[model samples]
Target: MQNNYFAAAPKYQEDSSNQQTNTEEQQIGKKAVFYYKMVAKTLGQYLSIYDGKTEYKMGVVMHQPAKPDHQGGFYVYDSLDQAIFADVPLKKDGLYFAPRTVIKCACWGDKIEYPNGKIAFEYLCPVQDMGMPKGYLATKAAMKEAYQLYSEKLKLKQGAGPKSLKKPTWKN
Candidate 1:
């Protein structure tokens, strides 16, 4: 079984930038493109950084074909397979019918098989951030960098560093 992961196109909103608005289409100004790209860049970086790491668990939900054995029931594969007896297309767009499954994780989990031959597993998902990548060392590093940058901006705004704590000169 092979492991396959994919990233979908970002969902863009017309009013995301709030610069200009069209009553007919309700579209915003040109800033929306930049804003959308920024969001996509951040998300792409987060995903890439996450995939580059070794300590992660992943899962996928795919559409299976109609098999005589498992008729009507869906099929889940260890990896993406375009050719399967019980394969189902994921999207409804074109006639290709490629399965529109979501690989929920970047790694595998403990293998558990059911009596009915169905397989189940758990992925390496951190508890923080509500089952997403949180508490990972790399994630922590990324967050630390972001925090440092924000802290620097805050210092510039306040005209003082983060250490400038206003301790009461005279105790109450």
Candidate 2:
């Protein structure tokens, strides 16, 4: 096996306009600055699920349980699922549980042909097709519980988890 290493790189650019007399900056010609990035720890794998009714394409990050049993659940997010489907990268803050609002709504549009043959369209949520899932960001234990109910497989009393994550409920 090949050994690998990672070096943290500067994540933010220096502000040229700021002239604070910090001792480090005063003594050094230049310095590399690094910002901490918070990775979204699992409610297990991040995914999207279609609720049969109220919720549309609800984006969820859930942790499915392990072994010969049953039971599971999922925390709900009213944001970013559309953005994820639209190829938005996971933010530095990762998947946050922002309450559902118009800001997170994605839009769909159609080709409108004017009388003169000019075509136009706009992406706007029809409201009727909007996804407003219920539930809050679950506590870690809650996430585990949610997954238990949703996933078909049950967790063992004690053993390792499966090698790969289960697929999302809907295609990205």
Please identify model 2 stretches exceeding 4 Å from their true place: 1-88, 92-95, 101-122, 125-153, 156-172
Segments of candidate 1 deviating more than 4 angstroms: 1-102, 105-139, 162-172
The superposed Cα distance between candidate 1 and the true structure at residue 133, in angstroms, equals 12
Against the unseen true structure, what C-alpha lDDT does each candidate score? 0.28, 0.28
Candidate with best lDDT: 1
Q: Candidate 1: what lDDT?
A: 0.28
User: How does candidate 2 score on lDDT?
Assistant: 0.28
Lowest-sum lDDT 10-residue window in model 1: 32-41
My TM-score estimates for the predictions, one after another, are 0.20, 0.19
lDDT of 1 at 128: 15
lDDT of 2 by residue, 1-172 (tens): 1111111211333468764444432332133211111122233321222221222222211122221221222222223442222222333443433222222222212323334222222221111223233663333345567777655355422223454544334566
